[model samples]
Target: MAEQTITERIGSADQVLGVSRREIMEQMIDFYKLGDGDGMRQMFEAYKNWEVRYRDGKRTIDETIELAKDNFDCVARVADGYIDSGDTTVGMVRAVQLPKSTSGPISEFYRKTIDYQPFDPNRN
Candidate 1:
């Protein structure tokens, strides 16, 4: 089978979870923007793995999303250092640097989810 596109994956996830893709994507972008590359990468991998398990009937969609959210929270904790310092601009820059630190699934997730646009620190 051909690899699924992000849109397809989002559609599948939304259908199963009964949520809008944009809502999920927006939350993901928020998490991605706030998270360091390593944490974001780990979160992406965890989500992907959970997605597979969900497909295989080994996980529930709620469990999968909760896992994703938990991973995202981990990254948020990491971002707290920057946020607490009142240097969120620098923090966002650091978060965007995550893609540079890794390749493969995380990078692909970042690229596709962000639509290949450069990270905008000003985006709220």
Candidate 2:
């Protein structure tokens, strides 16, 4: 019915400066899917465990997608930069760029587990 505060669910350290930690992990998985890195998947498994531990389904899914989008956007930005600069290192750097808040669309079905902030589906 209502979103759980970070304290009630995941701890505060996992929260990024602007985005939720769950979002970060989810996005990293997406990045892994896009050939970003294998670590993302590993991170996903870890987060999944945390999801069970905290009973934080909503936050887990929400953050997962957000992180995916963040990773994708970061890579896209690196691609754009390389396109403009003709430098290869930029792409390489993008490969290592961490996930962000604007990752992807995690299912809201998690409402049963924890409180979630209403996200605008239209916004990435």
Candidate 3:
């Protein structure tokens, strides 16, 4: 029961970035382990501006929302890494490929904002 509860909590962070929640969580854990602040994650942790943050439209995940893809940023990015060994990760989503791999923890990470670029949304 306890284990299920823990999983349930983690599962709340559904992966809409095309990357599995587990994979994103692992990368986030690893990054935090190294003391790196995933600024992107912090910004939209608890449904904070999540609707307008990703796309721009009805912001409802119903059958109607699907039809609004063209009007919104429907096609989001995939989760990967800023840099990798080609075996563990692939390309970056944003940000420069820092030779040090600081952002490497989530370079190609799109949805979770752990990718190569910073997850700063211009919700202005």
- Top lDDT: which candidate number? 1
Q: By the lDDT metric, which is better: model 1 or model 2?
A: 1
Candidate 3 per-residue lDDT, tens place, 1-124, comes to 4533222343343434333434444544454456545533542243332333455454455433333221111112113332333322333333223332233334333233522333234322
lDDT tens string, model 2, 1-124? 9874333333322433233543453453344346544444344334444444444466566575555444434544444334445564654354346232222222121221123333445556
Better candidate by TM-score, 1 or 2: 2
Superposed by TM-score, candidate 3 places the C-alpha of residue 54 at a distance from the truth, in angstroms, of 5.4
How far residue 42's Cα lies from its native spot in candidate 1, in Å, is 3.3
The list of candidate 2 runs beyond 4 A from truth reads: 1-59, 91-124
Candidate 3 accuracy as TM-score: 0.25
Give per-residue lDDT, candidate 1, residue 109.
48
Cα lDDT tens digits, model 1, 1-124, are: 9975443454455326444433333444555566545544443564555465556456677666555544433334334425445464554455456543333333344545433333335555
* Candidate of highest TM-score: 2
- Candidate 3 residues lying further than 4 Å off, grouped into runs, are 1-16, 38-56, 60-124
Model 2: how far residue 61 lies from native, Å: 0.5
- Cα error, residue 118 of model 1, in Å, equals 17
TM-score per prediction, in order, is 0.27, 0.28, 0.25
Q: How many backbone clashes can be found in candidate 2? A: 14
Residue 22 lDDT in candidate 3: 40
